[model samples]
Target: MTAPAPETEPTPPPGRRERKKQATREALLDAAFRLFASKGYEATTVEEIAEAVDVSTRTFFRYFASKEDVALTSQEEQFYAVLDAFRRRPPEESALTAMRHAGTLLIEALEVDGLADERMSRFDCLMRLTEESPALRAGSMERTRRKNDEMTRAIAERMGADPERDLRPRMFAAMASTAFMVAADAYRMGVCGFGSFSEAVDAAFEVLEKGFAEY
Candidate 1:
């Protein structure tokens, strides 16, 4: 089911005004991460993020509801893309195989977008914030569980299983989700025996997949 990455072209901006708004939004996202990285996520206030971008706190709220919201915005973008990628996987593949490929696309996309590097990435800041802040980590855990459930539905559809009656899809989805997270963390800690995060994730899935047969 795993195919090459999709190459969809981006649409041109509709007009100058919309482009300007988008620029502002992008600037805010970048500025927020920079501030969160430099000043500490808890210490960095919304006002600081707004002021860093030469905008009012009111304008900041216009773009993002809260600090946590801005912190998660980039992740939200990638999460949806992974879901879409899951739908593109070949149907003949088992749910676990399909998920192994689609799920790793999360890391693949990050690498392609030039955000997977430990250095020289705003996402690094976001990751650090999520790791350091108890509140952010709690929110992230709940968010991950919800997103995993969404993947569970996709897995059920691919496998032609009744989600209401079948528990296998959900279990497979949960395993894939945990595997990806563990792999990414291992890569971050330089213990995954891989150069790339995507490879780390693949290795994690491979090792995890071998477990049930042993027992």
Candidate 2:
């Protein structure tokens, strides 16, 4: 008797469609960044970005709610990644030490991923855009505020303090964030040059460890 015919492989269902959507979303982000850097964020229209990525205006909206969202997507992930690292610090470490370690790890990862240059480039564009556009400025502030909240919770957890009752965690996190931003700004402005982003972060943490009393 002839063997029964082998069943044909089943086709993938709707989940494959979701992955395609994600790829399209990332492509849109890449296209948007390129346009914003070259043409200026304010002058770059949604239609232009959609066209650059070979998608319709309606399709762009399906991925990003607005142009501002494009500037913020990767930054949000970076902030959360750092906060998560801080939250896992050893109990023996001081809050400041924990933050320094977390920051170092984050910088290392950025460098490893070859995102340091890209991040600086995007940040430069974002700074310029925010300075010129009130709407973009508001979006930037909102992103910072959200990151601050996440850092506060991470600090509180690391210190074994109640996030609701203790103000120290929030204060420390705010100060740490401020220090990091100042260092980042210095690097961007060419005030300090280092071999790698991690080196810059290490130098900044050293300065912080030395205390701002000298400043």
Candidate 3:
């Protein structure tokens, strides 16, 4: 369990209006997932999702840019969170160590926090939806591809290495991304006797650290 340092600044709570806005966004997201799961992603419409939440089509656009955007929202959130975490790690830690901690820390927070159960349930729906829709999977991959560059640059800056000259940052970024997905899937499937999502993530990064000697 990663405990917060006393000196680490706490994130201020969102204002009442922001909380209300977030609630509406979540409601719209849940409604979209439910409709997508039932009606098929290709068949689901933004208007239908808004109707499910008793909101208008224009309101849906206010929250999500498009139907695809809503479908990939949770995933994109995690990616950015990981990047933020990676950037915040102590400077002395190696890139891989920093990434592993960053990834696992975020996953652990997700499992332990107040919103844990609800977010995980949402992730479950998203995973199943992704498997069923080739378009969603492709869209997700494209987003990951674009986001990985940001992660690679972050890692490069941490190491004070030239990203254009050194490939290590790119490798670490790609590996961390893959490890995150594999760990989440393993935890969700629960076939390997892992106890939590963070445990799965820790194990995934350990294999990389050891150069897969155990495997």
Q: Which candidate leads in lDDT?
A: 3
Name model 1 segments beyond 4 Å from true: 5-22, 118-134, 209-215
Per-residue alpha-carbon lDDT of candidate 1 for residues 1-215, written as tens digits (9 for 90 to 100): 23464455786857998889988998998888878878888998988889989999999888898888888877776677778877877667666666678767767776898867732265567778888999988887788778888888888888889878999888888787788778767887789467888888778887776776777
List TM-score per model, in order: 0.79, 0.80, 0.90
lDDT tens digits, residues 125-172, model 3? 777777988988898779878898898899899989888999988987
TM-score of 1: 0.79
Candidate RMSDs in Å, in order, are 3.4, 11.1, 2.1
User: What TM-score does candidate 2 reach?
Assistant: 0.80
Clashing pairs for model 3 are none
Model 2: which ten-residue window has the lowest total lDDT?
A: 1-10
Task: Arrange candidates by TM-score, descending.
Answer: 3, 2, 1
Each model's number of backbone clashes? 0, 0, 0
lDDT of each: 0.78, 0.77, 0.83
Q: Candidate 1 vs. truth: CA RMSD?
A: 3.4
Candidate 3 colliding pairs, count? 0
Please name the candidate that would achieve the greatest TM-score relative to the true structure. 3
